[model samples]
Target: MNRVWLPVVAVQGLWLRSTLRLASAPGGGVSGTVPGPAAEPLRLAVLGDSTAAGCGVTGDEEAFAASLAREVAARAGRPVAWQAVGQFGATSRRIRFRLVPRLDDDLDLVVLLAGANDVLAGRGPDLWREDLTGILAGLADRAHRVAIAGIPPFIRFPAIPATLARHLGERAAALDAVTREVCRQSARTTTFLEQPAGTPPADFFSTDRFHPSTHGYRLWAQDVAAQLIPDQPAP
Candidate 1:
């Protein structure tokens, strides 16, 4: 079975509500209020692939955008309105083509979590770097605070084919390198979130082992929140 592109069933909405509740709990330490202008909620935009869209997770709330918004709001002491723009099989190239133009200048923060599809498509590092650079440049030029999430390790998942899995693993490393280089070159353009090693595939992924589960989005949201709020460290 060529399960490379198989779509994982979206989880139920109840799962999202439950996850949000847990993430919002005081013990969870996920909530943080963003203190700034009382002028409406801070607008946050997320762009990427299935992970960014919370494909494996059920409902929008279970996605990273929702969790991050909640956390940022709690910590920053302000309200946040999160907008997610993602596609299941999107790559960096596709993001450049489809998602970039839709971004609003009013967006306070932009989170980009892409490149896995580019890896699957066998895109070269140079091309990945080009597209990512252009994306970051566009955002920076507009004075939007941006953060680039590293591609998580996919080879550890059991559902993928061995050959494709191996390729993805190598590609992830290459993409990470290019991402770092771009971040260094871009002037205060994009912050890089390094994917932590040893994160169990099950904890971070859904049943299909491709998209992130609710837990996975939480983890990604934590990383994003840390970047947005330097005072708080991501666990």
Candidate 2:
């Protein structure tokens, strides 16, 4: 089926890329201080691709990384100091090799949101698992906890054509399964947070219809907050 759809997907992908180039807006970095009243400061790092970098939103406060920090702080009663390192088209392999080596601080938590590009690029599940294993190992020395953010519903994204989206979504699900297994095998790696596929795509997506909007960020943060501070009420 993918063979039959590949050419069509490729054509649509080219148009989609051009459209995104024109439609995508500059998203502010969601790094630095996420203020709270708690005396203890939590050092956090977010590592992955565009969604991890908060591509759809304009400001840091509106990005998922910043929103998660704020929610975690509100729930844990501690200040969360966070830094985000990601780009729009980065793959899991790139993140493991290029991005992970540059980290300079010990962190309380690290949130990883990637694999969408990997799925789109037709990376296999075995390779994804290997990359995830390496990524978690790399983070073991840097953070006390590593949280894996599961892939979104690529099939539901309005920017993606249905045929390509279905193939990508299936690949994303396969990669996510690998991620879950990797997390389960590691004590330092915690939960895999995911967006429900049943969700209305329009409500959670941004104007560009690919990356997350503020609403999506808030929802994702809520999920992360629940995992980070399980005892506290959901934010």
Candidate 3:
């Protein structure tokens, strides 16, 4: 099926790339604090690609990284100090090599929002699994806990044409399967997080119809918060 759709997907992808302008990443320091009464902050680092960089939103505060920090802080009843380390067209291999080196040690949490580029580029699951394993191994030395954000739903994004989206979505699924196994094997310090169920795709996307909007960020944060701080009290 992918062979049948590959040519069409490629043509449509080229057209979309030429026609749609990529959104700019939010400016300023990618680090911030979600205010709360707790004296100490739960440190967080979000590492990955464009979505991790909060490309769809204009400001850093409106991005999903901030939302996730707030959600975690509110639930944990502690302030959250967070930083989003991301690039526009980064792959899992880049994340393992480039971004992981940028993190500080003894952090509370680290979440990886990778795999979209890997899937879209049609990279094989073996390469993805290898990169992910390396990333996790490095992250283990940096943070106490790590969460792997599952691959994005390419088929649901309005910006993606149907044929191309289907192929990408299947690829995403394959990558995610590898991610899940990696997380499970590294279960001592890692876990995988999925997209929030019941989220409306129309509202979740931004003007580009590819990256996440502010609403999407909040929804995603809430879902992540639940998983990341399952034992923490609700705010």
TM-score of 1: 0.76
Per-residue alpha-carbon lDDT of candidate 3 for residues 98-179, written as tens digits (9 for 90 to 100): 9989887788999899999898777889999899889988887789999999887887788888898888888888889898
lDDT of 1 by residue, 41-122 (tens): 7778777776666676656467777888877876677788777777777888888878777666767888888988797677
**What would the TM-score be for candidate 2 when compared with the true structure?**
0.87
TM-scores for the candidates: 0.76, 0.87, 0.92
Q: Tell how far residue 1 is off in model 3, in angstroms.
A: 2.8
Off by more than 4 A, model 1? 1-40, 141-143, 161-164, 201-203, 232-235
User: lDDT of each prediction vs. the true structure?
Assistant: 0.69, 0.80, 0.84
Top candidate when judged by TM-score against the true structure: 3
Residue lDDT tens for model 2, 1-235? 5598889978887877677642234374657776777586899888988877788888868887888888888887878888888877889999999888866468988888889889878898999998988998898788888888888888778878888788788888899998888778774557787665476635788887888789988887887788668774578
Clashing pairs in model 3, backbone N/Cα/C closer than 3 A: none
Better of 1 and 3 by lDDT: 3
| Lowest lDDT block of 10, candidate 3 | 20-29
